[model samples]
Target chain A: MQRPVPRRSGGGLARGIPAVLSVVSAFVIWEIYVRVSGISPLMLPAPSRVLDQMVQNRVLLWDNTVPTLKATFAGFALSLTVAFGLSIILDFMPRVRRALFPIFVVSQTLPLVAIAPLVVLWFGFDLTPKVLLVALVTFFPMLVALVDGYASTDPEIEDLMRSMGATRDQIFRAARFPSAMPYFFAGLRISITYAVVAAIFAEYVGARAGLGIVILNAKNSFRPDIVLAAVVISSLLTLILFSATALLQRTVLRWRDVEGHR
Target chain B: MTALSLKDVSVTFGDIPVLDRINLHVEQGEFVSILGPSGAGKSTIFRLLTGALPLQTGTISCASPENSFAFMPQRDALMPWRRIIDNLTLGLEVQGIPRKDARAHVAPLLRDFGLADFTTHYPAQLSGGMRQRAALLRTIVQGRSIQLLDEPFGALDALTRTQMQTWFEDRWRAARWTSLLVTHDVREAVALSDRIYVLSRRPARVIAEITVPIPRPRLGRPPSAQAHDIEAHLLEILLHQTGEKP
Candidate 1:
C-alpha cells in the first residue's frame, strides 16, 4: 500500500489553538460571572446560551450574514479596483503622486462614522452607501503599499536595466511590478479585514439586511444570545477573509522565497 | 580599429571636474584595465562610456563596428524578482527580442557559466560569486561587442574574486570581445588586461599606461615583486594625485 503524504497543519490553526482556548476560557468566566452576579439574560447571555441561540436561529443568522457578505465583497472589490487603478496612475506620474498623496491621507482622516450617515443620506439605505463607506475605509492602505513598493525598487537593479537599454515600461514590468508584489499583498491583507468591519459599521447605521441589522434587531427584541451569535458570525467572516488574503499572498509571492531575499 | 575613443573628454559634477580633458583609446579586441585608488575617477570613465554620465566637453565615442556596449557595474544589479535566465535575457527582452528567442540564446550561456541549475532561482538565492557570474552572463547575452566593466568582482571575497578572474579570462579569451575594466586590484588588472591606465585622483587624468608583460592564466600565488613594483609605481602616482604624498 502507498503511504499517504503527511499533512502539515496550518500555522494559523496551531497559533490559533491557544487563542481559541483563551477566548473560550474567558467566555466561561463571563458565563459564571453573569450567572453569579444576577445579571438578567436580556442584559448578557452565557456562551452556552449564545451557542444554543446560534443553533436555533441558524437559518436566520445565515440570511443576515448573506447581506453583510454581499456588501463586504462588493465594497472590497470596488476599493481594490479603485486603489489599484489610482496606484498605477500615481506610479506613472510623479506630479500626480505628490499632488494626490495628501488628498488620500486626508480621506483617511474623515471619520467613517460621520461619513456613514452622510453617505446613507446621500445615496440612501441601499448598497451604494455601504460600498462607498467600505471603499473609503479600505483604499488608503492599498494605495500606500503600492507606492512604497514602487519606491522600494533597488536602484542598482534599475541602473542595470537602464544600461541594458530597457525602456521605462520594460523596467517597470520586469522589476518594479514584481518587486511590489509583497507590499501589495500586505496592503490587501490589512484592507480585507477592514472591509468586513467597515461593511458592518455601515450596516449598523442603516440597513435592511446584514449581521449589523440582525444584531440591532436582536438587541431591540432583548435577545442577547442572538446578538452574540451575530457578533461571532461576523468575527468568523473576518477570519475567513484574512485567511484567504494570506493564501493569495503565499501563492503570488512564492517566487520571492525562491529569489533568496525577501 | 579602435573600439572606444575618449578625446579631450571632461566630466564635471557642478564646478568640480571628476575627469578632466582625458584622452584614451582601446583598439578592437584589446583588454585595457583602468587602475587607480578609490575616487580616482576610473569608474567615471566607464560611466561616461556607458552613457551613465554625459561628457561635459569634447567627444567620447566607440569606433567598434558593433558599436553596442554592455556595462557590468560594481554591484550585482540583479533583480530579486527575476529568475537567473530572465535576468540574463533582460537586455535582449528590452531590445525587442522575443522571450522565446532570448531564452534560446541565454539557455546555452547559463549552462556555459555553470548557472543552468540556477536559471529558475532568484538573485537573492545566489551566492556572491554566482550572482557576479550571472550578471556577467546578462551583460554578455546582450550581444554587445564592447564590455565596460567597473569592478564586476569587487564585492566578492579574495578567493571568489580570484576564481571569477579566471572565469572572466577564460570567457574573454573565448569571446575575444574588446573590454575596458576599471579596478583597484593591481593584480586583477595585470592578470586580465594587455594594458593598464593609471589615473590621478579627483579631476582625474591618465598618469601612465603600464603594459602588463605577465602572461595569461596567472594562477597559484600572487605575482612577483616586479609586478608589485609596477603596481607600487601606479600606487605612488595615485597617492600623489590624492595629495597623500609630498
Candidate 2:
C-alpha cells in the first residue's frame, strides 16, 4: 500500500505570510515610536526622517553602495570558487582531509573583527582588504557545507556506480556531487547574508569608499538619520542577495520534493 | 556457457564470519536466485562478486566483459535532483556515454518500462512502485548481460510486492538476460527463479539448490498447484534457517 506523503497545502507563499506580516508590523511600530517619543534626531530620528534622508542623500548613498556591492560580489565569487575547489580536493584526498579539517576548525576561532584590522593593516585602505576579509569569513561555511555534503552521499549509490565500471571521478560526478547540491545551496543562502555584512565590516576597518565609511561619517557628524538610512540600505542589499540565492536554489533543485521548495 | 561461478567462496568481516562457503553458478541467460532469511549474508555474496567487499577466502570467476554486469541495491538510490530519465540513464552515462546518447538509447525502453510519460518527473513525484520500476529500468538499461538484484521489491507492501513479482517475471521471460536475484520471499523465488540456492543464516552456506519444474507465469496469473508446493518447501527451509517453526 502506497502511503501518500502528507503535504502542507497552499505552497510556499502561504507559509511566508506570517513573516511578511511580522516585518510590516515591526516597521509600523518603529514609525510610531519615533513620532510619539519626540526624541532628538541625533539620538533617534523618526523612521520617516530616515526614509527622507535615504532619498535626499540618494546620490551619495548610491556612490558608496557601489563600492560595497562590488566588494560583496567579488568576495562571494572568490569564496565560492575556493570552497568548491578545496571541497573537491579534500574529498579526493582523504588523508589531506583528515589532516586539514582540524586546522580549518581552529582557523574559525580566530576572531573576524581582529583579523579584519590586520588584513587592512597589511593590504592598506583599498578594495583588496575588503575582498580578502569577506572571502576569508564566508568561504568556511560553504566549505563545511561541501565537506558534509560529500559525506552525506549514500554509500549504496557509490557502490552502484562502482559496479558500473565508473572511475572515482565519474562516481563523484554522477553521485557524490549531485547528492551535495541541496547542502551546497543551503550553504550559499547562509554565506550570501554574511557577504554584505563582512564587506561592510572590512570597510569599517579601512576603505577608500563604501557604505561602512558613509555610516561612520554620519555617526561622527551626529547625523543619525543618515546612519539609519545607510543601515536600511545595507539591510536591503543583504535581503536582495539572499532572495536571489534562494531563487537560484529553487530553480536548480526544482526536482526536489514539494516540501523542500518552501 | 557458464557466465559466472563462485567456487569455495567464503567471506568474513573482521571477527564475524558471514559466509562459510558458497559454490554457485549462473549459466548464460539463466535466471537464478539465492534465497534465505534476512541477514543471511546473501548480499555479502554480491558485494564480494562486485568487489565491494574483499573476498576473505575463495575464488570468483567471471568471464563477462567489463561493464557487462549491473548491480541494483535494495533502495531505488535515484539521485533526488535528477529527472526520471536521467536517473534511468545514470549507469550508461557514467560509463562514458554522453547524456544525449544515453537518453536516446533509453528512449525506446521507457515505454516498455511504463516511464515514457515520466521523463521529466523526479523520483519523489513518482509512486514507490514507479520509482522501483525506474530503478529496475536503470539496471537493465546498462545493457549488461548479467544483472544482480538484491531484494528489489523487499520494501514494498505485500500487494505491490506481489504485482511487481508478476511484472518482473513477464519482463524477465521476454528478455531472459542472465540474472541472479537475492530474495527471501519463498513464493517470489518459486515464481521467478529457474534454479534456487537456499542459504543458511549468518556465516551462511548454500544448504539447498532446487530447480523449479513449475510452468511459466506461475504467479498472480493462476500459478500451478506445484508452484505452491515448492514455495511451501522453500519457506520451511528458510524458517528453519532462522530456527523458527514453519
Off by over 4 Å in 1: A1-17, A35-38, A259-262, B64-67
Position A53, candidate 2: lDDT: 91
User: Least lDDT summed over 10 consecutive residues: which range in candidate 1 chain A?
Assistant: A1-10
True contacts kept of each: 0.58, 0.60
- lDDT over C-alpha atoms for residue A172 of model 1: 83
Best candidate per TM-score, number? 2
> By lDDT, who's the top model here?
2
Interface RMSD of 1: 8.4
Q: Give the per-residue lDDT of model 1 (tens digit) for A69-91.
A: 99999988898898888888888
- Point out the worst 10-residue segment of candidate 1 chain B by lDDT: B60-69
The positional error of residue A214 in candidate 2, measured at the CA in angstroms, is 1.1
Off by over 4 Å in 2: A1-17, A257-261, B244-246
Question: What TM-score does each prediction get for chain A alone?
Answer: 0.90, 0.93
Total backbone collisions for each predicted model: 1, 0
